[model samples]
Target: MKIYDAPFIRAADRYTIEQGISSADLMERAARACSDQILKEHPDIQQVLVICGTGNNGGDGLCIARHFLELSMPVKVLIHGHRESGTEDFSHHLRRFESAGGICESYSGRLPDIPQDTIVIDALFGTGINRPVEGTAATLIEQLNESGKTILSVDMPSGLPANGIPEGTVIHAHHTYSFQWPKPAFFLPENAGYTGSWSILDIGLRADFPGHEHAWGEWVDSSFVLPFLKPRKTFSHKGNYGHVMLLAGSKDMPGAANLCSFACIRAGAGRVTLADDGREETRDEIMHLHRNKLVPALESGQYNVFAAGPGLGRTPSAHTLLKQCLESFRHPVLLDADALNLLADDPSLTMLLPAGSVLTPHPGEFRRLAGDTSGSLEMLTLQQQLSARWQVTIVLKRAYTCITTPDGKIYINGSGNPGMATAGSGDVLTGIIAAWMAQGLSPTDAAIAGTYLHGLAGDLAMKEQGGLNIIAGDIIDHYNSAIKILRA
Candidate 1:
């Protein structure tokens, strides 16, 4: 999915309003939907405290306050003084709430004293904010954030820019309720502290906005990506799906190749060939390498997919095999583990990479590939640059796995959890992408579908067996189940 910026967010909202849905109706739906989630999560939240500004965001808070009042719940609406008391939807909500006798207070340069346990609702800013927040509103937001209250930000956190990492006093929301499409800020690693546990609420935005040609980033859910997974055909033979070549493992680390091969076979590859150190410590294990570690699985005069660098140790022979892959492979490649480590040391090796090759790197490996960064955002910027320059795909695995492509597309993976941060997980990911690629997905699509599916599989495993003790093979064990759940 494409990452949307502030302009794209504004365009989406305006497009919806122009499509006959009033902005007031949109705000009302967003606020009420947020309340539904809040009420569900906290059954005891009867006295709600809403802090709103003078813009459409404030309109949302007012609408939400009205929604609570309609439900016979006590609500306190605090309005911040700004240059623009909105005239469109804001005016409509302001009048409706006031007529309903909703308790309203204007923040005239003062933070009002309130009960200790009130849930502070932050509706002061949205994704459209362009400048650093200042004045009384800024001070109020900071004070509220530091107040130890369970805060819920309506859209984007106040004082946070929608694209890059936040730098100022941002609302430390316990939970953020975003509407319609997710803003790019919600997914960036740096914003996690500000946007705590975000949930998207349906606010009725038009799905068919103009210039649908423009790409936008999406937060992946199983429902959204299920169609991309091709169902197996009954007539399909082992040879028909495609043979996947795997180059991984080291002297003491046969488990890497084990995990990769299993994932390849499990994900429905026609055949899986494993090549590690010269001696196949085990033969029924599989395949052979030309130079001991450089193995390409070929059948019927054609190679299917290639995956390298799982538990591949940085030995003289391993580097040689990696270099060979750079120069020779015509098919798509999934580069991971020590493969990226080797590439980082040899800048020239990057030139051998074929267009549309996929490189999956954890943050440290990404730092090695892009060099040290000031922070995660800078690392991401460099990742984007490299994707465009090399015309390949880079999957920077993290709390939210990010996939950037040669076409300048970036996708933040929403699947997976803390359990996936274990050893040999990267090998499972390599196998997944390779499996999809062998089955005929383009490198970009393969990475997205593969990463999303890989994470989803981890999630499934965590549910049944739990994450603390989950191993790489367990991911493979649950891979089919995750895909099945998605397809269903």
Candidate 2:
């Protein structure tokens, strides 16, 4: 699904309104969608206290209150501003809700002594908010957060900007039901607290809206990656799938190379050659190579793709090996772990990287490669800048792994669990991406698809091991299951 900023979202809304549906009708659609989801999810909601503002977002809350009221459920509307001063849609919903005998009151400096079970619906602001929230509104937001109530936001959390980082006090919603599409801020780690658990509520926006063509980013889900997978030919041989050369693992960290090689094989690499010190246990299917023979192997041109860095240490020998790989390999290489660290140590090595190379850097590695930034948003900007300038695909691995390509397209992965944070997980990711690249996927497609599959595998592992017990090998073990789901 394509993600849009506030302006694009507003434009889509206006285009929908211009397509014959009145703005009030659209607001009703949004309200009904959110109301249905809330009621379905929380069937035992004892009471609802909608904190409404003087805008269309408030109108959505008013309509939602009316739904609960019509069902004979206890509900109340606390308006931050006067009804007469509200927007046209807000006034329309307010009058209708009042006609239905809805209890409406002005929010004073203090919160009401309502039942603890009441769900506070935040409709004080929406995506159009550009300035910092202040005054009584800020106080109300803070009080709501401190009230220990289950706060549900409409469209957006009151003070959080739809596109960038929040500047002032924002409502800390336990759940947010956004209309049409997810806001860009929803995917950022910085706003995860404010948008506890968010879902997009489609309000009948035009499917063919032109504004969607210029989306800021995309939500990478199954549908977005399904097309990238190709069915295997019945007559194909092992060579048809492509061979992968993995230059990973140090004498002390052989587990990294083992984990990476296993993941590469499991992710469908026909052949995997691991270049290590040869002190670790070797799998029957994997070919082992000593560090001394690595230079000659690259010159053979037998491997389709190469992945370096994982357990590679930052020693001078490791540095020479990385430089050799960069100088010898003509195909796109995947650099991760200490390989990225080496590049950080010698900035000039980045210039030696082959075009279309893939760099999987966790936050610390990314900071070292691209320099530190203020926050995730600034880091994201830097990620894009580096990808464009270097002509490489930078996979910034985190809770929501962001894959930024050379063309400036950003893909936010939506399939990972916190359990995937274990050590060796990133090595597993590097292996998967390299495997995909070896199988004839373009560097961009390989990175995107590999990221989605890696996260999906982690999610599958989480199902069996639970979040706390999951380890990196668990992710590798579930690669087949993840691929099956995508193929299915």
Candidate 3:
């Protein structure tokens, strides 16, 4: 799914309104969908309190309240502004709701004593909000948050910017039912608290409306990644998959190398070679080359892809190895863990990076690579800047991993959970990306697909292991299952 900002959404709404269907009809469609979903999800909702503003969003709430009234459920509307001052659609819905015997009350300075079981619908603001919420609006939002009741927001949480970071008081909604498409702000980690769990309510807008505008980024899901996954042929041999050379593992942190190697093999790499300093208890299937042999191996051109860092320490020798790898490998390499740390330590090594190289950095590592920022939005800007400057793909690892390509396209992975936050998980990601690159995927496709599959594997693991004790190895264990689901 393509992510659109406020302007694009508004344009799409206007275009939708221009396409024969009246704005009121669109509002009714959106309201009916939301009300139906709410009724289905919360069948026991005895009372609903819709806090409405003086805009179209408020109109949606009014229509929803009327639907509830028709069903013989007790519903009330608390209008923040006077009904006469509302928009044409808002006034229309308000009059219609009132005619249907719906009870409406003005929002005074104080909130009424809301029952714990009553569902509160927040329709005070929508995606068009561009300024900080203040005065009575701010107070109402704060009070609603404090009410300890389930709050469902219409279109957007009041005071939350559609495209940028929240500046002031925003409604902390339990869930937000977005109309047409999801707002770009919903994907940002900074806005996660305000958005909670959001779902897009399709209002039957014109499909071609977004084609006229540019999308901020793509929401990476199964459908988005299905095309990138190539089916295996019956006649293909092991060599057809491609060989991956992994320069990982140190004496004390040997588990990183093992985890990465296993994950690479599991992700469908035909061959995996590990360059390490004679670590004990190495896997039998993995070919090993001494640390000194890495330079010669890079010159040999036998490997299709290269991945470094994992357990590689930040020692002088490690720096030398990284420097040598950068100087020798002309192809795109997957760098993570200490490799990224080494680059942050010595800024000049970044220049040596091959074009289209993939850098997977967790927040701490990203802060080191790109200068520290105030929040996720600024960090995203810096991520994009660094990607353009270095001409590499930067996978900023997080709960929602963001992949920014050199060409300025962003892809956000919507998979994985908190369970994948364990140690060595990034190493597993590095292995997966390396495996994809080795299998003939371009640096960009490999990064996006690998991130998606890595997260999906973690999700699968979470389903079985219940996400509490899920380790990095567990993600690797479910790699094939993830692949099967994607392939199917």
Candidate 4:
């Protein structure tokens, strides 16, 4: 699941073509893959409205139209855009369709008066779009979106950029089938409106070529994140999986500490110690040797993998606990929630953080610490500044959770559905990250793996039950399953 830049996709095609897979054959494979998926899920669909252009993209639409016609499905192919000549594949398919007597309509100005029940196939602008869609193509995509029918987009939703934020007109596809690899824009948050549920269709592009990069950002699928989580040996010792000193929970918020502690234990920390706000109720949940809850208990002879925030209440005492961890904790720390709120209140606390500490904050928590954003550009600028100033990995939790490294590489996680937006969820993530740090994973790997696993767990949970029953406990329960799947 290597996500590549638009250039890499083009380069991949060149490599394939060099390997004797002609452009036409490649187009055939991609189109057939789309047709295969469509027929598998929508056998009853008829009267497909495929809007084709004159490039290789139109070749894909024409190929699909040709396939459907062969299946005895009545498909009306609407060809648009003028070209002196089309690609060899497009010309080949155009002749084949006419020879088969399939209904074909060519239009450059006005779209055909097709039936509203038609399942529209948008292939006018694939991932090759470098500029804003204009003229009839732009208007047609907008009309298709408003048509209230099942719209399928080829490669990518038209007009969405290959990598960063989308710029102009985009076909809001019910489903987008990409060829071989995924483009970066597929994972961006703003594109959520245009790019609906998408799947990458393997078109026989050889993986023998170079793999894709984070140019499109990280996809939190099992294939991408699992390698970072190696198998633990049966002969492994407690010392082998490092001890985690966790500082979370506040007075009544003791449950936050409980969640982080429970999650850390489940996530495979060799030994867990919690330096929580020493409260009566908080002490009740501490399981002595199993869940250490005291400053003295965290005086491990060895270094610590600390996790702070979670159920930590917003109080003066919570502030003291965070400053202590920031100043003294010798190992990498995972900071979240109230701990971040404390840093927001006290600017000086930023200097106290040890290098390599990882901060995980949803957008609100981030704004409070980094200050209000003037716009989207400022939001990204602030995230970059914080990572540089603290010399720590920053996980700005958002629609597509991003993991920013000290050196400034942004890895956007592609796991977890909307079901993960629940209470105490951040606590679970805190524990998961701490466990990874304890297991000797670098802060960068831990953050990336933790976010991906958390989201994958949520996705798996959502599949069993709808996204509504999603809870923090459900994430914990599915954590092992996610790890196991990644291992497999």
C-alpha TM-score for every candidate: 0.92, 0.98, 0.98, 0.88
- Candidate 2 has its poorest 10 consecutive residues by lDDT at 275-284
Per-residue lDDT tens digits for candidate 2, residues 327-360, read: 9888788999999999999999988988999999
lDDT of each: 0.80, 0.90, 0.90, 0.78
User: How would you order the candidates by lDDT, starting with the best?
Assistant: 2, 3, 1, 4
- Model 1 accuracy (lDDT, Cα): 0.80
lDDT tens digits by residue: candidate 3, 372-471 = 8999899999999999999999999997789999999888898989888899999999999998998899989999999999999999999987737589
| Candidate 3 regions with alpha-carbon error over 4 angstroms | 210-213
Off by over 4 Å in 4: 83-89, 108-110, 206-216, 228-232, 235-237, 280-300, 313-317, 371-389, 465-467, 484-488
Better of 3 and 4 by TM-score: 3
> Candidate 3: deviation at residue 188, Å?
2.0
Better of 1 and 3 by TM-score: 3
- Report the C-alpha lDDT of model 4 over 370-460, residue by residue, as the tens digit: 8897654467667877898789999987667877788877777878877788888889899988988888889988888888988888888
Model with the higher TM-score, candidate 1 or 2: 2
